[model samples]
Target: MTDGPIITATGVVKTFGGLRAVDVDKLEIRRNKITALIGPNGAGKTTFFNLLTGFDQVDAGEITLDGQNITGTPPHRLAAKGMVRTFQLTKALAKLSTLENMKLGALHQRGEKFWQALIPGLWTRQERDIEARAEAILQRFNLTHMRDEFAGTMSGGQRKLLEMARALMTDPRVVMLDEPMAGVNPALAQSLLELIKMLPAEGRTVIFVEHNMDVVQEISDWVVVMAEGRIIAQGTPAEIKSNKAVVDAYLGAHHGEDLSKVELA
Candidate 1:
C-alpha cells in the first residue's frame, strides 16, 4: 500500500434506461496491491469496471489513474496509458490463434497503417520483437503448448488464461480483472489465483471483481463491497466479513454461516 491511490473514482454513476446500474460516490484502489470488488448479482461491479476501463460510457463521474483524469477515455487510449482490463466472459477472438490474439494486444504496430503494411522493412523487426515478447508471456502462463491453437478451441479456463496473458501485452501498470475465477475448473482456478496474487509483487496494481469469498480472502489485500448500486463497505477481507452492512446487503442470511461454505455466483 502507498500514501496515494493508484486509481480513484468519485461521484460515478451509470444507468441503463430505467435501471441505475452504478452509483459510486468514492472509491480508491491502493498502489501495487490486490483489491477485490465483491457484490451480489446486479450490484454493478462489472458496470463499474466497464466505466473505469472506458469499455462503456458513464452517465456521470470522474476517474483518474495515477492522478491523471481519464474519464471517458477510449479503451485503446487507456491501454496506451498503462491501464488494461480483462473481461469476465473472456474476450479472446475465437478465429485467431492464441499467439495471434496476444500479438493484437501490443500497441502501436507500424504494420497496422495501410501505407506501412506494404513496407516490410518498416515493421518486420518490430513485429519479430513483439512476437518474441508474446511468446515469453505465453511461457509464463504455461500456454506455450497452445500458442498455435485457435482460442475458440480452448476450454473455458484456458480462455481465461489467454485473456490475462494478452492483457499483459500492454505492460500495464494497473490491471483490472472482472470475475476472474468464474467458470474456471478447480485445477486451473488455483493456478489463476496464484498468478493474480503475484501481480502486485511485480509492481502492478490489481483490482478484480470476484463473487467467491474464499478466493477473495485468499488473494485480496483490500476488499470493497457493493449492493443496490452503492458501495456498502470497504476493508480487509476479515473486516469485510464482519461488516454488518455487508452482511445485511450482500451476505444476506449467511451472516453467521462459514464463508468457506458460502458459494457466490
Candidate 2:
C-alpha cells in the first residue's frame, strides 16, 4: 500500500432537482484499511458512493483514485483501473452459471472481442486460465460447489458472495461494497463480515456502507458518519461512539440512548 490516501474527494456535490443529495468538501480514504460509511436512511451515504463509483455524475468537484482524476469515469473503466464496486442489491446474472458469471468479471479476455471470439484457438488457453482463477476464488469464498449451478438458484447470501468474488477477478485495489450484510441471514452475514475483514490483509482497501454498528465496530479502522447530505463526524470506532454529533443525528431527543441498538433512521 502507498503512504497516503488511496482515494480522495474534493468539493464534491450532487443534487437531485433542488435538493442536494451529496455535498462534501473533502474526504480521504486511507490505504489498506477498512473504512465504514454510516448514516441514517437518506443520509446521502449511497449517493456519495454512487458519485465516487461513477454510477452517477458529480454536479461539482474532483474525485481521484490513487492521485488520478476520476470524477466522471464510468464503472467499467474504473474496474479496469483497479477500482471496483458491488451493488446494494446482488447483481449476479440470474441465467448464467456461477462460473460463467465469474469469467465475465475477468478483464481483457481475448474472447470478449468479436473476431477473436470466433476463433477458439486464439483464446482457448486464456479461457482456461480464467476458469482456473475463477475456481480458486470460488473455493476461497466457499462457493466451489455452486460453480455449475445457475445464479438464480442460489440463496440471497450466496448470490452476494458471488458478486464479491467476481469483483476480485478485476484484482481491484479498492473494493466498495454497498449494504453487503443487508437482507442476509445472521450466519451468512457473519461469514461475509469475516471475508470483508480479510481484504486489507490481502492488500485491498475497503469502503463499505452499512447500518450495523456492531459490524462497523468489529471491522472498521475508521468510521465516517453523515447526515442530511454532509459528513458530520469521522473518527475511530471508539471516538465515534462518544461523538455527540453522531448521537444526535441518530437519536435527536434521546441523547443517552445506546447508539448501536437504535436503528439509524
Candidate 3:
C-alpha cells in the first residue's frame, strides 16, 4: 500500500487577519506512515491541518491527495475523495445517538437523496448495511454499549473514541487527527494510542497534531516541527528529538541556560 507520498503540499499559505498561519514551500506525507506534526502553541500546526483537509481555504499554493489537486475543496467533498479528519475538540453530535452519529459519517448514502427517501426499497437495504457496519466499528472501539445513548452523555474520552470511530465509517485512505488525545483520560489515552498505531496496517496514512512529546516519540514514524507558520525541522523521532531546531522551537534560545542566577520578573 506504500509507494510515494499520499499527500503533497507546495507553496501553501494561509492567513488570519494579518497573521500568516501557514506558509510552507513543500511537504510530503509518506503513504501508510504515521506522521506527527508538532510545535509550540502558535506554530500553525492545526491551521496547516485545516488547509490540507479543506476545513479552511488556502490563500496560496496547492495541495494534492493521491496525485489529485484538492486545494480549496470543501470538507465533505474531501471526505468523499478518501480524506477525512477529526477535530481537536471532538465533533460528536450531542443530540444524536452514537450509532446515528457514526451513520452520518458514511459517504454517498442513498438515504441522503430526497427521491431515494420516498422509495424505501431504494435505501432500506443500504440502511441496514450501514447500521451493521456502524455496529462493527463501535464494537472495535468498545463503544457498542453506548450505541443507542446520546453522544452528549459520553465522557470526553468516549467522545474522542466516538469521533475516531465515526471517521472510520468513511473508510478514508488518509486520516488526519487534530489533537486526538487532548482532554482524554490516561486510560483512554492508552487505548487511543494503540488504535492509532494500527492505522498504517489498515493501509491508511495517519497524520496527527499532538503536543505530547511522549506520545509523539512512541508512535510517530516521522516527525515534522513547525515554528511561526513554517516547518523548522523534520526527521525520524530520534532525529527530531535531538534536532537543534526542534529544541529551539519548543524551548527558544534560552533552552539550556540556567535560571538560578537570573533575577525574578
Instruction: Please provide, for model 2 over 141-230, each residue's C-alpha lDDT reduced to its tens digit, 9 standing for 90 to 100.
Output: 999999999999999999999999999998899999999888889998898899999999999999999999999999999999987778
Lowest lDDT sum, 10 consecutive residues, model 1, at 256-265
> How high is the lDDT of residue 211 in model 2?
93
lDDT tens digits by residue: candidate 1, 219-243: 9999998876778788999998887
Per-residue lDDT, model 2, residue 132, is 96
Count of clashes, each model: 0, 0, 0
Candidate 2, pairs of clashing residues: none
Question: Which prediction has more favorable lDDT, 1 or 2?
Answer: 2
Error of 3 at 198 (Å): 0.8
Q: In model 2, which regions exceed 4 Å deviation?
A: 253-265
Global lDDT scores for all candidate models: 0.90, 0.91, 0.91
Candidate 3 lDDT by residue in tens digits, 1-265? 2487999999999989998889998999999999999999988999999999888899999999998899999998999999999999888899999999999999889989999889999998999999999999999899999999999999999999999999999999999999999999999999899999999999999999999999999999999888788887789999998877677657776444432222222
lDDT of 3: 0.91
Candidate 2, run of 10 with poorest lDDT? 256-265
